[model samples]
Target: MNTETGVTAQTRPSATSSEGPDAHSAPPTRGQMWRHLGPGIVVAATGVGAGDLVATLIAGSRFGYALLWAAVVGCIVKIALSEGSARYHLATGSTILAGWRSLGKWTSWYFGVYVIIWGFIYGATAMSATALPLTALFPELPLRAWAIIAGIFGFVFVWFNRYETFEIVMKILVGLMFIIMVGLAFLVAPSLPDMARGMTFELPEGSLFYTLGLIGGVGGTITTAAYGYWTQAKGWRGMPWFPMMRVDNALAYIVTGIFVIAMLIVGAELLYSAGIALEDSDKGLLGLSGVLEERFGATIATLFLVGFAATSLSSLLGVWQGMSLFFSDWWYQLRGASEGGHEGSGAYKFYLAWLTFPPMILLFADRPFLLVIIYGAFGALFMPFLAVTLLMLNNSERVPAHARNGVVANLTLAGSAILFVVLAVQQVARLLS
Candidate 1:
């Protein structure tokens, strides 16, 4: 039951037989497994958008190194959830939506409403986020103009490209983002002793919300749920693919952990010691750019802005692609299509258009109050919903006995569910009030 890899009835060949590596004949070597690391990179790039960076920056500005431990713990918690998602897919050779469907019609109802509404709201949000640094860098255009251009760019790119092209572009963007963020952290030269002290568990005064936000916000989003679909897109399909999938998931989040910790270091060394405060929004990253210009110079500030654009655009591209894949699968499954929807399908294009067009209206004017309320309520519950559903699906008989959740996996996922539930309650309360 505890073995790392084995095949079962649920395991099947990839849909496009040429996509995945040949893992069935013999166990893949470390080098071979590393070559197959695409989906995890996609997930990581998609998950860490501009908003996540701002949240971490704010946490570091407010609490210094005090909540560093929470950020690391957040990564671990997400690792558990994402691993469970990929594990179910590999062990059962089914999509997560299919797993949700097996649970009951209630799952479909929740997802159908959630994905559509989430797409509409998040489209505007993602476009605005991607546009910020661009507007900051090139001020001739208004923020709204840059946002629309960004949305169109993402829509065109995803609409025309396949998964292979998408993955390659994502890797390039992720690499650029990694270099810029980690480079800035090094430029600041953080104190080693203070960082070490931050590793010990201690929350400063008035730090509870910031601490929770850090733990909950680091490199996680609905993108975590899209991970299994990504694995399938990469053509990994069974128990034989399990070991490689685990490695990919862990490494991606490890990169995410480093990326987030770098931002925290920037906040701690550059802002906290000086008592600088950043606005608690995506625009706050632009505030950091100003700080960078003052201290480092125009060149470094421009570099930071470019990195910011990379971060934001990568997220926009990822959601446009990954969520569209998810929406297509869910719709086709609901209609009982034997051969499920794929890229370039009608449902897929509809979602891509849906994500790109309808939300553009919100950019021109304020988001409607009622729609905002509904989006917040549903969005807040999504993480908890994912955590809970994974618990039910993975522990039940749908998965093979050998690939079921171990004790550590169970505890970590259970903890994630509780954490997200708390966050959801707070978010809903804040939104309604």
Candidate 2:
């Protein structure tokens, strides 16, 4: 029997197709498939924040179509990681943190410290990043003032709403961003032959970190660990939902793949073609805006900025809500409180405050140097942390035998873990250097 959804092995649907045994219902139709696309969209939007765009833009600016293949590989890695995570949720019906607790108590403390530090720093970064396009578009308010306003807006939205409302807002933001990015991509009109050559897997010298960064960082992060919560929030049940999970994940990441590919096209066609170098920060996007103005005029630049705002704000809101759920669950587990109903819990509120208010200090005053160091230290290791943990949980005897990790899943997870480890070490080396 499947432990999470209480369905027997005989009734479990194949992950590839919605089709399953006669005892279970037939696969969901295309309409139903469209409906199941919730949590996946949420995860995708949350993971591909401003920083991810920066990395991809830099990669494209430096190498043009040379590293485009790495972006595709990065999406595949994300699919495998997200599939592993969603599988755990479907097989166990528990949050990832709970699964971690089963692994050992040390995981609890590790995640706690990591989030405590990372959330504080990320909150500041995300808000400021969100404020960038707004400041560019509307210079009426100072950047710091706009950032504080953005932070408060996310805080109020996440604090008062439930997951359903949160998902709706996220979908809207994802839609806006998607339209803008894809539109921008088409405007660039990259060469098809160059893109094909990029697919041939030639990693140029000196672009190894850039390549690895694309593979390791493209649409993958701590937000993935929160994916299970999204699954639960979406109210999917039964072993039969596996195919829907599969479809949902595949389609969502395809959208993410498109978004990344679009940004890369922009990087290659616009900045690279024009020989304009962007600052290796979120401000790089603003620099790109000036390019758009020079080429496509102010209207296109304005549209791009709107899209950028949608993308950054979606990340801020998703992290605000999802990680609050993470801390809330952790608090429940730590305090030995009642199993569920932590939405209004103190820990949830505390983490929300952590994500929202404390970082406002960084908008004005200096960030604590030690806190920044610790954040990068732990943050650097998060992808590998999730990959390794998923490998442990999904391969354990807890999941139904038929539902356990298959060969492809195993290899993918292992590769992701190893790649993330290399990336993490590289990040640490860079930090120390």
Candidate 3:
């Protein structure tokens, strides 16, 4: 992995060298799998936060497997969008923030405003989501207490560890959640015919909103923009690393797509089959855990809850780390200090603090509605911001000819932009209403 320029360096053999022993060496082994699996894990873990789970469960409960296809499509959209961002970083040797900054100062201003508003709102949401399971398991503690603990824990982890340690921890959490959640899906034995029909992509009656949400919700967020930073941390840069980066990204989302679909299967088979409807909150997950306990016994249910907790915790940590990095860069650029001694400065810690602490005010506020609304509005717009920008940046002359956006890439990104705009409109309407 080359870290100098953001582009991945190519490793393809020349046509004449294809027949050599080096070229014919045995294929990469299982042990080598770990090397290529890093970025995917981070992307998936970041994308599959608590909000995604709630959306999937709600869709399953309302329409069974009808929306599974949308979930898969969402994963494809994410791969295209995230890959585009990563490719830009790998090809340009610059951060996404730098790319956006190059476009114009307005790009920087929009991101700055969005991140501050988004982080404060998201901090409370992530803490509350993590607190739900903890409060359920230990009813003696207040939810506020649990939320504070979760927030502080996330803050400590991101503050203490550097990128490498953070990646390893998140990978473990992702593995645990993937195994338990997917394992539970198999145990419930989903209906193949129903799943196949879902693959056909027809929207069921009264499910237009659900379908849109599923398409917009699958493993996506502001964290998608963080792909380049993570790639830099992995020492991956230049076009030589492009093949491996693509493979890493594709495999990551493949796992994420499977994980989300498996959850939908669980919802369809376990909850929907039993006529269970989950609420639009993390508490809904606790209710589902109760159903799991009743059907599969206490042990399986406990495992599922643990996985749920890990997912929420990992997300908390990820947002704290990734968003802080984004905010710090934007802040420095805002001060017109694009170069000099301020590059890669220590300002990220301040943003991390902002994410962890200020939101606690909402945890105890008399009314939390305004905070939630502001958060949702900004959060809704971020995907479109990323998609539209990537389309513009990757196709611009700033990128080298070899790495410029081709027709297929442009089409995919355009579709993503359209889809995200629709979702963002719906989200705003919901907030205003």
Candidate 4:
């Protein structure tokens, strides 16, 4: 039915594109479950970059699991957001952009400005983050050189590979990263009883912002809205794939929570126990690396850096591909074109190019404070924006009655919006001060 590339359920070229013989053909087998889980995994891996890990580590270092429940809550919020997005796409065959446009022209303009400003700033940030561990791993290369190389590597990889191949590569990267995280957690030997204590619904003194960050910042971003495009790209369309999509989404976030939980334990046992403060940034991860080397050996430090690279590069690839999906679909819809033209289309490549190259100029210059504030405020507010809009869309008559937001979905979305607003307000206050 689409007019752009004229692609349909039957016409998708990827080997894994078919949802199944039919949507409701049968329950997914083990192999089928594995196949359909790509989109959520991409979102989780994308969102949990170095900054997220550092935030969790800082929280654990300072509060010692007093905010542990917040991390679990963060995963739950993301699951709700991911499910709502997937449901909208399958129910309406619509993109999130289209859903926003349904709300009002104001929503459209807001997203346009947000995406332009957010992507320009985030691109440079993502590259610098990726460069950090690589420079640590190979001390000879300056961070700037490593950053540009990281950006180029992400660009070339995503530019050539479609969703299926990209998904496969990311799966491998996350798997390797997972092993490293788990191994580090083991080395730290955190007490399970203390972790249990931390899980209680209690907040530490003066840790309000840290708690809110953990709640609002786990496993989500503007990229979370890209879930639908990934579902479509994965060849799962219509109501039949709905159940499988939910399963896929839930499983992905569960893995995200586990990875993050391991990180918290590392912070608790290593940094908290030792009275170490990482000063709250990606540099904290580097400081953790030095501690790991001091305690375990150089080999341990080297492995962690490798895992860090995997985490960083995985995010870079996801954003490069995920944002391209969003921009391409937006351009297609705005021009009265079909959604089918979106995969690696002109706009797709343009955004991909934007994410990779233009940001490199900022890598060479000093980062501006005003640009950081604008980026920070929007970045902080995005999840709240997403939660609020999803509440409107999924609850509206636009989605199928059966698939619309139920009580649990509504509760989670509402809670996510509130939590994000708290974090957003706090970020604005800090920036202004």
- lDDT by residue (tens digit), candidate 1, 330-350: 777677654445777778899
lDDT of 4 by residue, 230-307 (tens): 877777777878878888899888989999998999988899989999866677789999999999999999999999
Q: Rank order by TM-score, top first?
A: 1, 4, 2, 3
Q: Best by TM-score, which number? A: 1
Task: Give, for candidate 4, the lowest lDDT window spanning 10 residues.
Answer: 9-18
User: Measured by TM-score, how close is model 2 to the native structure?
Assistant: 0.91
**What lDDT score belongs to each candidate, Candidate 1 first?**
0.85, 0.82, 0.78, 0.81
- The Cα RMSD in angstroms, rounded to one decimal, for candidate 2 relative to the true structure is 5.2
The reply for model 3, stretches above 4 Å from the true place, is 1-33, 336-344, 366-370
> Model 4 scores what on Cα lDDT?
0.81
In angstroms, give how far residue 179 of model 1 lies from its true place: 0.5
Candidate 3 local lDDT, 1-433, one digit each (tens): 4322232223311101112111222323455645556867887887887778888988898889888889988888888888898899778766677678777778888998788888888999899989987887788999999999999998888888767677889999999999988998999998888899988887889998878877777686788878766766666666776776778888888988888998898888888878988877667898888899899899988888888888888788878877776776566555544332111345677888889999998899877766766676668799999999999899987789999988988999999899989989988888888
- After superposition, which runs of candidate 2 have C-alpha atoms over 4 Å from their true positions? 1-31, 339-341, 366-377
Q: Give candidate 4 regions above 4 Å deviation.
A: 1-32, 338-341, 367-373
lDDT of 2: 0.82
RMSD of each: 4.0, 5.2, 6.5, 3.6
Q: Would you estimate the TM-scores of all the predictions?
A: 0.93, 0.91, 0.90, 0.92
Question: Candidate 3, after superposition: displacement of residue 19 in Å?
Answer: 36
Poorest 10 consecutive residues by lDDT, candidate 1: 1-10
- Residue 215 miss distance in model 4 (angstroms): 0.8
